[model samples]
Target: MAVIPVALAGRSYEVRVGSGLLADVAGQCGKLLRKQRVPIVTDSNVAGLWRDTVATSLEAAGKEPRWLVLDPGEGAKSWRVLERVMDWLLDEEVERGDHILALGGGVIGDLTGFAASIMKRGCGFVQLPTTLLAQVDSSVGGKTAINTSAGKNLVGAFHQPGLVLADLATLDTLPVRETRAGYAEVIKYGILGDRAFFDWCETEGPKVMAGDKAAQDYAVTESVKAKARIVAEDERETTGARALLNLGHTFGHALEAETGFSDRLLHGEGVALGMVLAARYSARRGYISEADGERVVAAIGASGLPISIAALGMDADGRKLANHMLHDKKMDSGTLPFVLLRGVGEAFLDKQVALDDIAHFLDEQLKTA
Candidate 1:
């Protein structure tokens, strides 16, 4: 097991990455499970695969696992489902001191964490992220959110988890497509900050997708460590340091909106293509060479993730797509800050970006072969 600490001043927590963390849930969470009735929020899919393991663990520790299983998918992160989760948590008589377990992917973690954040003006929650995307990215960050009509993650808060158990064993049951989607975030860490790690990914990314345990361990642990350092430095994203984590998110969210935030493009998939766009846009702005941009595209595409917006077959044109970004939460004073690449490992936030130029660039991409 690799333990990475997200070193926030007073609310610091550990993100434990390993196998059987879920099976050892009681021990992993320890005193965080304060009550006999432990409230857990998860999706039905995760419940089907992990409910028994978690239940048995807590039961063995003389704790009763109370579950609120939600319908699986992005829809669960909406205001309606959030209300349901809040009502259910209230019914369970949860207290601010007690920790609620978020036992699924990013959606579960985000929604549960948001509920906990506003619950009684802030409660504790543990993240047991089942998906690779969650383990490597969303689970560690305090940025919890739900998608609104305006855009993805438009409604949320920065509620940190008390503990995060990223059990590698859970990936065994993840669909291949899901695993590949998660790899996008995994590679993202390398692309944004570590050139050597990016080089390593160019070779070992395949091993990770192939179920190589060692590769998976290294990938998850390293990604967590990278995120932990940044989160420790800037927990609230007030500093531009933390915004580097949004390397692909701005463009990705727009693509997500165009796709109706459905199965047509998973969040990670959108991010994958978004990074490609960011890289290409960076090259167009003379920040990086054209070869380097294609290199980003190649690495993402090699991992079976989409690397082109043209391939999405969307009816929306560039202007329509760029208009979607108008609702982006990152927009400040009518200017949206974009995370663009200076090189493979160098990402900087550019606040001078014009939506009109982005529309033109996206239009060119939409016509790409």
Candidate 2:
């Protein structure tokens, strides 16, 4: 077990990463939230998967909670779902001081935090992320959001969780496809800042994907540590430091829009393919060599992830897919920045990207692929 701390001044909290940390909910989370009643918020799929294990731990601390099990998916992160969840919290008479126990993956955490933030202006919330992607990324960041008609995660809040307990054991219940998808985020950390970590993934990644507990523990802790440092420096992304976290997200978001954010192209899968495309585009721009682009693709492919655009089968040309990126929230002054690679572990922001050039390149990729 590795415990990483997010140094957010008054809102600082510890991310407990281990095999069975979910079962220690009360003892661990109780240290921060000294409330009598805690509300457990989760989606139905995750509740069926892990609610009891976490609930029992909270009950042992003498805190019987008001559980909110919602419909699972990105669709749940919506104004309608947010309204119903807030209604449930209100019906249960949950006070502002009472902590919201968010169990499940990123969707549950995002929705619950968004609800908590708006319920009484601001409230307490705890994170118990079950998926690898959530454990390493979303659960720690305070960027809670509900999607809108314009794009994904367009409506939300910056409500941080009081505590984040990530239990690796629960990952066993994840479908193999999701498991593979989550690894893409793990690779993101390496591609963004650490060359050695990328090398480590190439070697130990197989073991981690094969359910090797040691590798999983180290990867989660290390990735959390890396992201914690970034979030601590710039929690609200005002500075360039925080924006680097979206290494492949620009292209990844476009792919998600093409797929409708469905199970067909999971978030991490889109990211996996997007990172490869970003690398290739970067190479085309003379920012990186063809060799570097191939390295990115090879690493993602070795992890059993989709690294090619053709694999998405969206029935759209690259330019049409590129149009999806025009709506990305990261667009600045009506221009979007691309997170491009200079090498295996070197990614920098390219705000000089021209939309016409992107459309032309994407057109070629569509023609070839």
At residue 224, candidate 1 shows an lDDT of 95
Query: Model 1 clash pairs?
Result: none
Residues 214-233 of candidate 1 have per-residue lDDT tens digits of: 99999999999999999999
The residue-by-residue lDDT of candidate 2 on 85-134, one tens digit each, is 89888887777777788888888889998998988788788888888888
Best by TM-score: 1
lDDT values of the candidates?
A: 0.94, 0.85
Model 2: pairs clashing at backbone N, Cα or C within 3 Å: none
Q: Estimate each model's TM-score.
A: 0.99, 0.97
Candidate 2: how many backbone clashes? 0
| Candidate 1 regions with alpha-carbon error over 4 angstroms | none
For candidate 2, the TM-score is 0.97
